[model samples]
Target: MTELVRATSGRSEVALTFHGAGDLDITRQVLAALAQHGAYVTVLAVGTWLAARPDAAKMVLDGGHELGNHTWSHPALSAYKPEPMRVEIERCRDELVELTGSPGAFFRQSQGQHATAEELLEAGKAGYSRVLSYDIDSLDWRDPGPAAIRHAVAAASAGSVVSMHLGRPGTVIALPGILTDFARRGLTVVTASKLVS
Candidate 1:
């Protein structure tokens, strides 16, 4: 099957997913904002980041967010050969399993591009059912300020899977406004797994 970019469940719901691997302080801020709005997200975490801060797994899961593999070093997985690619995917999966008792439900590649055939194969080897992708991107990593980030995600609608980054303060700043906009539009924000389900 192809990578999932959006859900076709015919519901007025959207998923907010973040590229995980950032400062713990910023992550805490992002979680606090989401908690304030009673929203949940999926964090596709980098393995190096997880190794550096193993507590981050509990921090994310405890805040009602789930974790997924984004590879070991956040490199473009497609650039590597099959052996290294498998290592990247499985390494991150191992980290997740070690910390959270599971490899998570999805595998999202570094850089948030659509998964390649090789990526899907390696991901399957690592125990992922689907490669989670996104239809909308907030571009918060560019640090274009909160307004730009909000404007970018403002395009989300039902079935939209929005791509965001967790390591940036701009995302944390723009999150509440984005959630407010969704609330005003009568849309429900859900975790990626929920959106796909």
Candidate 2:
């Protein structure tokens, strides 16, 4: 798979990627905030999350946002053998295809871990052409408060892929300021695909 840690568009744009599978309510809140700002993002969703709330996945697509696999469950894929790893990735892809009529164009590993070479090859075989990594991690998972989250994202430069999580309340709280900061800096937030394109 083509590994992209950052976009290459060279425009005043950054890609905001959210990893989902925890809280649907917060996910909706995040989506709403993004929509309110006319910003589009990429959500890497866990398969179980989609199964439990297919409507949430639909909500993302309906909002004109991009979706990708974050594995069947959030597991450290590198811990598994090659075949099991493939199962983890492909199961998520299958669920996405079944739900959305497409498996999406990118794959993001659980916990934002870097995929091993074998994992990358398996992901490609499963139909995802790109494995996405992030240049800036919001660390919102730590519930570091809105200010810290804002600071982390505000520091993003051009071509950055700022990683954030969907279930975290801090992320929802910090999104408005983050978007405003991006706009203030003359940056446009785009999807991962759009950033690379």
Candidate 3:
């Protein structure tokens, strides 16, 4: 069985989730960071990105991370018709199954935005067990410096889900500090599944 870990006390455990695109460098950094802390991470990989970056995808699996569907491209599901969104979601799931050969049960909306709970229900019907969103956003995609990433993660509390990108240099530099800080605060870094379960 997977070891249980918690992000904070006095509440449901916090979740830290990462959304990854095709950028291997960023994904590698994130995986490395998680490994250093002896933790597993949740990765929502774009379907096309995974197809194009098999090496990186393998790296993530080898590092003991959980994979989730992030659609074929990073389209805002809210802006699309339900059929289109459903197609995208299924396509992502199929591609992930092909790449990792593991049945993934989580789906994260592209851009962290979904049209409604109905869309999430549709994903669930398609075999997704959870929909991920974040309470703490690193906003590293905005090119924030290391301090910004540090500050964002430091604000984490029990049950807070942090959003971060795999493609940011500042995030790489800030990862160690973030893990150490969480540990110092008596936070147990864990994968999203563990937190939610």
**Which 10-residue window in model 2 sums to the lowest lDDT?**
110-119
TM-score for each of the candidates: 0.97, 0.97, 0.88
Alpha carbon lDDT of each predicted model? 0.89, 0.89, 0.74
lDDT of 1 by residue, 1-197 (tens): 45899999998899999888889999999999889989988999999999999989999999998898899998878888988998999999999999999998789988646888888888887778799988898989899999999999999989999989978988988999999999999888889889888
lDDT of 2 by residue, 18-137 (tens): 887677898889999999999999999899999998898888999999999999998878778888888999999999999999997699877545777887898988888899988898
lDDT of 3: 0.74
Q: Give the Cα error of residue 114 in candidate 1, in Å.
A: 0.6
The residue-by-residue lDDT of candidate 3 on 1-197, one tens digit each, is: 11122333465345666777746877777787788888777877888888788776688778877777778888877678778888888888888888878646477777653326666766776677667766677777787799888887888887666777777788889889988888787777667877776
Higher-lDDT candidate of 1 and 2: 1
Off by over 4 Å in 2: none
